[model samples]
Target: MASRAPGEPDYQRLAFRYEPMAGRGERRPVIVVGAGPVGLAAAIDLARQGVPVLLIDDDDKLSQGSRAICFAKRTLEIFDRLGCGQRMVEKGVTWNRGKVFVRDEEVYAFDLLPEGGHRRPAFVNLQQYYVEGFLLDCALALPAIDIRWRHRLTGISQDENGVTIEVETPEGTQSLACDWLIAADGARSATRKALGLVSSGRTFRDRFLIADVRMEADFPAERWFWFDPPFHPNRSVLLHQQPDQVWRVDFQLGWEADPIEEQKPEKVMPRLRALLGEAAEFELEWVSVYTFSCLRLDRFRHGRVLFAGDSAHGVSPFGARGANSGIQDAENLAWKLGLVVKGLAPETLLDSYDAERVEAADENILASTRSTDFITPKSEASRDFRDAALDLARDCPFARRLVNSGRLSVPSTYRTSPLTTADRDAFAGPLEPGAPVPDAPIRIGGREGWFLDEVGGAFTLIVFAGQGALPDTDALRPDPLPLDRIVVTPPGQDGDPPLHARAVEDREGLLARRFDAAPGTVYLLRPDQHVCARWRSFDAAAVAAALQRAAGGEIGRC
Candidate 1:
């Protein structure tokens, strides 16, 4: 264990405990490698679904420094489902507005969450160590998870049925087997290396210095980005406020900058003074120089071994997509893997994980590549284009869309996913099939609550209704996979709660508006809270068919 440091998280080393099963040649259902935010999230989500998991990590303590600080809304919502969202939110700085500046002059700004009625904020800035600690605590509370620290996976081989792995622990090297293996060991993944897999993509030729400074300043909790600032002419700079009076400052150090020299306090302090003025008081808590690449494997799944998080894909940190997308990967995979492990769905269902997440990775890669290009243009023409966009953004609203100070992270919509059932009726909003279910305020049994909290972690049929009679959902329930139903009626409507399904009131009319629901709108949500199918009205047969499709049963539908 490490001693606590002032203005820093105490990095406590976890004692290595040898697993006796390694001596017995016993096999576990799921084994997750690397206990970072992604691996821990995967383990906790799997455990919540009654899937036993053996989580192993090479490091004994939490990662040093605030590696990933800007957590997006969708990631926080997933954390909320994992039982630690509130803790992260309370301990982190929350913000939605982001301002763009060009040469020390203020340009247009944007609000990530322009509208209200969402349960969580658009983004929360928290240190990665705090996130890992919270997720670690959640995993520790679950009996189904056995987390082993200081367990390094040195070798791996997978066949049609399972995967065999060799792990080097503090005691000795041992062989272990698992029915399924999730490789989340990060960008320099040992698991990916053992498999002889390749992650091909372009690596940007630029570096940035991240300085986490502890200061008692009254900066607003918003994202501030400057392009070609006066202090650092022809370079970019970003500012973000974090909890505990720590402000994250990123200075664009081009390819010519020496990373070793740039990280020293003498070099870093001058840059800070240039931005914060000479009289500003602050202490550097952590500092590092990093270059990023947008890359991902050709596929996320190989036989019974699945790759997740950075092991599966990676994006530049500009948009905070690395950890956010990794966490999304964990959420997207856990439910499908859970069903497959439980024999509720065929092993083929896991293929959808590959299809959907690959698309997501591609989307993130595209966005990240664009942001990197705009931020650090390789050619003079590209830099001119970016500058023009930023300059015109002040007067023209259309030009504002061209500026890319990191699109920020948003949940992916698996529109082409094999499991999605195309809408048979016209929809008026963004709640399309394969879209994540939007969260909204609601009232349940006269108590205020969130719409998503009432219906997730299972296959649910949500029917938006009015004061009219509720639809009968008795015939909608399927065997072996009972479909839970919820009736969300408009507020101030006189009605008795339905006996067959849980009922909630759309207190602010946000639910109905967000989902584009009318008196009889119906939506079938998967266990992961993504819409598989929807209709203008409740159709039991349609709901059942969509349910089957979502559960890996084709039912002769696309």
Candidate 2:
């Protein structure tokens, strides 16, 4: 077990420099409130896209405890685009399999990453403080991002053109303005409250006690869930491994249990001892009792003000959806906001962020709610059903699928989004419109790299011209927004030179098999790496129309 250090964060306090905003009459392009993972990620994404960003946080340091510990593959991929994926993966605990138990007997287990070829694993378990610190370092390295510490948003006013905000600093009050404002201030968002927006959802009556402890246990890096175990009869408990030998233990307490009493050392120590035996030696790291609710706002966007992360929506920790979904929200909005700010897309493009993410929130909320219900059955009938499922899961292979400890987070597909270009040709595999671009190993410049690494943070046009002549793209250029082209050719196509600077040889044929690509097939991808459109053959006019639709120019066509 790792020893605890005093004042763990030890981050330096940044000086607040206030300029006369009224006299200069200057308005920044974008202002992001909160310095958490979501806000810092948005700032980095925007800055990487050549947009100046102002990131303000009320706290001078990173998050105190390991608030969010699960980082999904999609979220990690987004972090990769923001320039900190490798650092995070190296520091975090990676795991792919999870086991579920009924009493002392194991019922079912599942592997999240069943397939290979992806650069990232299914998920990484790292403390929130580490993620925030890494994102802050990445943001500071970007010259276009200005991070202000100890600057809190006090008041906000928005008009047709932009937003005006009053910030409270350590020195005094300062006024700042921006064309757009992102509220990542967390669940009890001051920005959301000031905007008079309300979140609507159900709060579960059951409470869970979370305990982080440093113990030199020999448990493998996997999620272990127990229902009605001897140590905690008729209740549920979960355990996960994290970095620095810190283990997170969650015990489900009934509605009648007092939250304050459950967090006390006297009450918590007994439970820990029961789970880890009397002879186990361990140091307590952190403890908290929380009642999770599945809630979200009616709208994520209002005029010039936008919301992301927990401020936009919140879910139970059972599914590990909260932070992962928030990071996805930042990734989804950053590119659209960049295009809008750069005048490459219409203001209506921002509306898709609300549409796509609201749907994603609902999906997450639904999954989390189901998992919560299964874990903590509210009624006798529910309890019977859950027990029956677990009992059947032990013997029947089909019933194993019915067991749900928590449906670990997966990226949502925006199939019905307005920006998705409906497929005109039949495809076999999962590379459909609104789906994230699947990763595959490929050879670029005689170097090995994943497909996603080549087509991120920018609009990409991938043409699968198998050992044939390439199409002329000179006549079909989308203005303002830069479009990068990658030609994927057959294995023995080095004799015929590539039309573009970037060309990848489909060495293993994984790209062709996964995408169901044929000769002359073309795929148009968005900056967020979602497939927007595809065609059996490249048509200049059709591609142009699809690009226009993708940029939120024409309605009803997508």
Report the C-alpha lDDT of model 1 over 1-558, residue by residue, as the tens digit.
Answer: 111336544433334455544333878999999999999999999999999999999867777788899998889889988999998998889999999988877776889999889989999999888899888889989999998887899999878878999988877888889999999899999999999999999889999999999888877999999988989888899999987788999999999999999999999999999999899988999999999888899999999888999998888888889999999999999999999899888888888999999999999999999999899887889988988898898788898889888989999998988899998999986678899999999988888989878876889888888646667877666888856788888887534656768888899999998998889888899888899999988888988878888988872333
Per-model TM-score, in order, reads: 0.95, 0.95
Candidate 2 lDDT, tens digit per residue, 347-382? Answer: 889899999999999999999999988987868898
CA RMSD per model (angstroms) = 2.6, 2.5
For candidate 2, which ten residues in a row score worst on lDDT?
11-20
lDDT against the true structure, each candidate: 0.88, 0.87
Q: What is the lDDT of residue 97 in candidate 2?
A: 93
